[model samples]
Target: MSTFEQKILSTIETNQLMGSDQSAVIAVSGGPDSICLLHALCNLYDKLTATCVYIDHHLRPDESALEAKVVETHCLKRSIGFMSITVDVPAEAEATGDSIEACARRLRYNALEQVRSDVGADIIAVGHTADDQVEELLLRLIRGSGLKGLSGMGFKRGRVIRPLLEISRQEVLAYLDTHGHEFCHDSSNESVRFLRNRIRLELLPVLEQRFNPAIRSTILNTVNILKQEEEFISAESDRFYRSLVRECTNEKDPAGHHSISFATESLTTIPAALRRRLFERACWETGCRPDFQHIDTIDKLLAKPVSGTELHLPDGVRVVRQHDSLLFTKLTEDQGPRESVAYTIEIGQEIEGSGSYVIPVLNRQLDIWLSDSDPRDAQLMRIDRDTITFPILLRSTAPGDRFTPLGGPGSKKVARFLGDRKIPHHLRHLHPVLESDAAIICVLGLEIDERCRITETTTQQLHIRWVKP
Candidate 1:
């Protein structure tokens, strides 16, 4: 076996990119790197099965057909399976407002995944050399990426594996020449319009000659160090997310949206680095493509006393502060305003006896009963039955509402009262308030009126409990 084939086999073994007797879908673009990978894998037919998939991004209408034929002919000569697909990247880019490069990459990977599934393959292999890795590191660095992005591409991500990650472009070209194999050159690679092409053709050569002859190796070393550190941070981030963040289901539109919540108070306890990673993970889980500006904005939001503040981000994501918690939600097209709609709690004759009333608006249930003794639960509120007249009025808070909390000095506006308790501004108006004979009784889940508190001479005890879903 040649040195290139030995390196390929070694990389596969070291990274465990694929197991013996497994099937792989190879992404072949008829380029030197891809053709090299396909030829090497075909030579290892004893270890695994390989299928070639050529995806035409429709960017080069004149050249794409010929490239597909080249790859197909090579696969046929090697007695390997081959598939061809065409994706309209331009249409997708226009529809999603993404750059042509970004859209093409997205569609290419998606097409490869679909092909892998259709072929019942275990993994999808792509030819990404060490040169590509160096370029990627520079690209992400120029684009202002974090540790994870700076770490560059991995040998294996999900079902996609890059067996040529350790090989150089020079090595790939040498191997193709030795084997006397022909490959197509993409005209786009020579265009300086794309940042990657410019970096490859201009920046890389200049850096190698003018700055350091070993710039590629230096960048690869930096990527290796960053990848190790990022792995440790990623593991810690996962631990913190599992322990601190929680997924919240919207009962009204459970299938339409995705949401995640974490306590705002916990932000102070976490390191800034981990916090940013946590935010990114939360955004990704909720279907948002997080960026540096969005994350920085969220960090600033945490430092301010901006309860109920909200930020609408890309991909229809909405981030809001609700009292003590920060919520990340992927909003659907039909998702209406997040402001809580005003609702009234109608207490029927059930309030006079033991019964439960569902508060659909708040996704909570209120339980009331005339008790002979205290429930002793902190969540249960004990009231003096004789102190207030029934035909109790339960409704959302209104302006000018006032209540004297139990053991409090005097009455205060309901708005200020809730504010003091750190209730979110948007939810202050939606907070449930109980009234008896035009006298404010209590704010559920907060404090009860001092006038309605159970006393030593109280004859009847009224119990109120709030249950949340």
Candidate 2:
């Protein structure tokens, strides 16, 4: 066996990248690293079920075809199963603002995944060398990365594994040279337009020439240390999220919004380190990864008086303090108080004025109109027409109001009801209320006035239903 094949055998065994009988596909890009991976995998084809997939991202139309042909010829010489897939990337990538490198990489990986599934391959192999790892570390360090970013690419990300990370690019090139197989080179790699190209071609060589030649080793060390710190940070973050959150039920919407509040005492109780972790993970979980600026904003919010103060975060996200708990929500600028349309809903007609609006009145009888008839019998109530105050105003909940509340008694103030239920700050403004400019009428799906209950001597009955668009 050649030196490349011998090296692959050792690394594969060490990493448990592939068992003797297991199936794997090598992702060959016709580049030096992948070309070496293809050859090494082919050398062990007798022991392992190995195939090759070449993704032709149609950047250079003629060039891709030529490369695919070369890969096919190489595989044919070895009697290996070879699959080549073509994908258009340049136009689409430019439209999406992704650099050519990034778009091609994403497209190639996706194609390889589909091919892997089709071929019943358990693992997909990539040829990422120690040189690539070092480059990534320097690149990430330059970009102002945190622990996650500083940690260079893992050997395995999802189903793709890089067993050759321990190998050097020179070692792979040496093997290809010995075997008399020249790999396809991309001309775009010479361009200085992208930062990565300059880093890989110019900065790395100069550093290796003048500075510590063992920079790659320390780069690898940095990644390993960062990974260790990352694990501890993630664990502490999970603890913080668990420790600081409590749930409150919203009665306005049965499929109610969840209100997550961080108790000031609980937050203050956590160490400063844990506080940072808590905020970081909290932002990530809520789909808004708070940057340094956002973290500063959060810190400012924490310093605020613990009343009902709120802050609108970037990306339509909001952070608010209600009493003792901090809440995060996705909300927008109030669209100038929910465009109201009061057309005096008539009976026996569907009024699609503003959402599911319909008021059907009968001579002491019943008329119902709702989006779903899936029996909210328990949530439904009757009202006496004479007892109900007229000029019923339909609007979102306001402060200092009281309603009997569905499935409850003795009338709870609107603010108290929302607070006890933990209605999310965003939804609180959107929750519909029905009030008669007097006492609040049944807060739509919440409750009906005791005086409005249908009794023995009811003359007229108005059936009102709440709905959505």
Candidate 3:
């Protein structure tokens, strides 16, 4: 067997990335690395069925399609199954607020997975080589990544495998030359606008010429050591994470936010490093990006053991403490106060999002008759009809909006009031408050303005029933 075939077989066996009976899907882009990988896999693993896939990012419309055709023809000439997909990476980048490269990578992986499922493939092989690994290391280092990022991409991540990770780009080109194989050269790989291209074309050459002649090998060795250390730490952290976690529940509402709780005592006992990793994993599970500041905030909360403490993280995920437990929920944008619609209502008019009804009743007897206790009585609020002016403005809590909650002394911030009730920070915006002539007469669900409380002398009442949509 040739050296290229030997390396591919060794990488596969070392990682145990595939089974002999499994079919493999090769993500080919008609580039040298992918072309070399497809050729090596076909030659080395005759026992395994293989398919070649090309993803057209649609950035270089005509060029990308040509590359796909080259790859398709090569696959067919080799008698291997072939497939091609096109993605609008620029439009996706705009829609997702991600960089074009990031969006393209995400869409590419999604498309690859879709093909994988359709073909019932066991593994999706990619052509990421040691050169890409070194470039990624430098990128992550500049971005302030921790050990996990320093480890670089793994040989096997989920169903995606990199059979050429241990091989270099020079080696791939040499192998292709010896085999007399043709492949397309992507012009984007020369663009300085992309960090990877800059590193590959300019930075690596400088480092190799001036610093270390074998910088690529040196970085790969470092990544290998870091990856091993990371694996041990990850396993230990996962063990501790499972021990500390008590329950995870999702809100039944459409927002689909999750509620994750950990034992406060057990959490405080964990080492700070492992605890941070555990919290980071939890935040990632909830689709929130865990930063140092947010992780530190949670660490402080765990040490202090405050019952009602809460932290609002990025991505609209709310973390609330209920006694000894922490609840994580993703607050939908529609559930937030920023999306609130401001409107004025007269007698018998209803609030828009709050679903509260305002009905004018004649007397205390009529108030009791209309307010026969329903299952939703807890959401109902009663106020003296004569005390409020017409056209009361119904809106979400504004900054500095203060209200005296029922049976409470003095006024507190609407935000603070909601926090005290264990409301997820993101949902507080949806908590409606009624402003009558610039005075807060009610907080839709929790309390009625103390001044608006119905009394014995009040002959008429404005009955408000809070309903959730």
lDDT (Cα, tens digit) per residue for candidate 1, span 1-469: 7777989989999999987788999999999999999998878556568789999998999999999999999988887899999999989875654678988999999999988888899999999999999999999988788999999999999999999999999999999999998899999999999999999999999999999999999999999999999999999988887778444333333656777777888876899999998888877887777777678877776775757766555555667777887888765433322322112244321132233455666777666656576545887887887776544667778889998999989999988999899999877644688777667878987889999988889887777776663
Clashing pairs in 1: none
Better of 2 and 3 by TM-score: 3
Alpha-carbon TM-score of each model against the true structure: 0.69, 0.62, 0.69
Error of 1 at 21 (Å): 0.9
lDDT of 2 by residue, 163-211 (tens): 7887888898888898898689977678888788899989988888899
- Model 1, clash count? 0
In model 2, the runs with Cα more than 4 Å from the true position are 1-10, 13-16, 45-47, 235-264, 271-274, 289-292, 306-317, 332-469
Error of 1 at 241 (Å): 1.3
- What lDDT does model 2 reach? 0.65
**Per-model CA lDDT versus the true structure:** 0.80, 0.65, 0.74
lDDT of 3 by residue, 1-469 (tens): 8977898899889889887788989999999999998988888877668878899898998698889888988898789899888899988865544678888999999999999999889999999998889999998887678888899999999999998998988899999999889999999988999988888889889999999999989999999999999999999998887766544443444555565666665666778889889788878877787766677766765665556655555555656666876666664543322211112234333222221132222111111111222233555577776667544566667889998887898899888888899999767755667776578988766788888877877765566645532
